[model samples]
Target: MIALVTAALAPGIALLSYFYLRNEYESRTFTQVLRAFIIGALLVFPIMVLQYALEAESIFEAEWLHAFVGVAGLEEFFKWFLLYFAIYRFVLFQSRYDGIIYGVALSLGFASAENVMYLMALGIDSAIGRAFLPVSSHALFGVVMGYYMGCAKKSDPNNFKLWISLSLVVPIILHGVYDLILLTIHENVMFIIVPFMFFLWWFALSRTKKANEKMA
Candidate 1:
């Protein structure tokens, strides 16, 4: 009973955390955030399905390859493209914070789906750890990516591709490093990685503040 409850709630908590962090954006309304969340999830679903299908084919059978292609590669690719092509190009993403908003929304979408899968596999009790670590890290990576996008937009139109590439690279590197760390299955790298993530989160928050200040 306890395990089942944990499994179900873990995904909920992960989503809640994404929203909570995203609320750092002062200009965005709750309704807008919800809408972005929905759009992001819908956009990312196809990629998740692809990851599932590809993994099933044994092409992603290698443990290291699984982390690269199955986990980090597919997921980051989808989220990055969603924010870049779907929201950035179509929406009124004029300000830097808008980039953060879209980026985090993309992360939440990815996180929500991934959490549901883990909760089903490991159940609720084991979810406490995931909620604390992997869940938050995913969203934070999006923030980093989003920050770069905002900088690109504000800087020079010609440099947009460079910025976009960075936006994707930052998340992929963070995600790939974390996934590889966990795949080791025997190290206390979590201690190192957790603090490292905190640094990244802090840096992202500071950049958002800078953007807000610039907008002001």
Candidate 2:
């Protein structure tokens, strides 16, 4: 029973909290933000799960190429799609906060799916550690991307392309580094990743805060 609670509740809380923290913007009504978030999250979930499953099952070990590009590229592509379509295309988002809110929402969806899968595979212990770090880190990355999207949205027409391009490329590089660190966990080097991930998240959050301040 306790195990069941951990499986369900931990992922649920993590998903909720990650997005909630990113919802610091006053632009989106709760419902508008929630709507875009749910739609975008649902859109990305299956693609992420399938990619993880295929990579995990591949006979070729988790090689450098696969870990670096396949892992980062696939996830980054979907999130970029969410930014492109849900946040950018939809005239629905007027305020910059909407971008961050929706970005975090999509990330939470991916993370929630990931957490549930990890828990089911390794049981409660893995889920507990992931409950904070991996989950929150993904959301923070989304917040950064969302902040840039807002800036891009407000920028000159030609410059918008450059900002959008950077927004996608930058997150993928950061996420790729994160995957690199995890691949070495069997080497007992998990501790090295904690500080770096902390630093990365802090940097991302600062950018997000700056974006919000600019909007205000």
Task: Please give each candidate's TM-score.
Answer: 0.78, 0.81
User: lDDT of candidate 2 vs native?
Assistant: 0.68
**Residue pairs with backbone overlap in model 2:** none
lDDT of each: 0.70, 0.68
> What 10-residue stretch in candidate 1 is worst by lDDT?
16-25
Model 2 per-residue lDDT tens digits across residues 19-60: 456555556566655665566456555776677687777833
* Model 2 CA deviation exceeding 4 Å by range: 1-25, 40-45, 52-62
Error of 1 at 156 (Å): 2.5
Number of clashing pairs per prediction, in order? 2, 0
Total clashes in model 1, counting residue pairs 3 or more apart in sequence or in different chains:
2
For candidate 1, lDDT tens digit of each residue in 1-216?
Answer: 655645644554455454446443445456665665676567546876787788678887677787776888777887777677766766665567667776776677666666666777877766778766776777777777777887777767898889888988877877877777777657787677777777867877776677665542
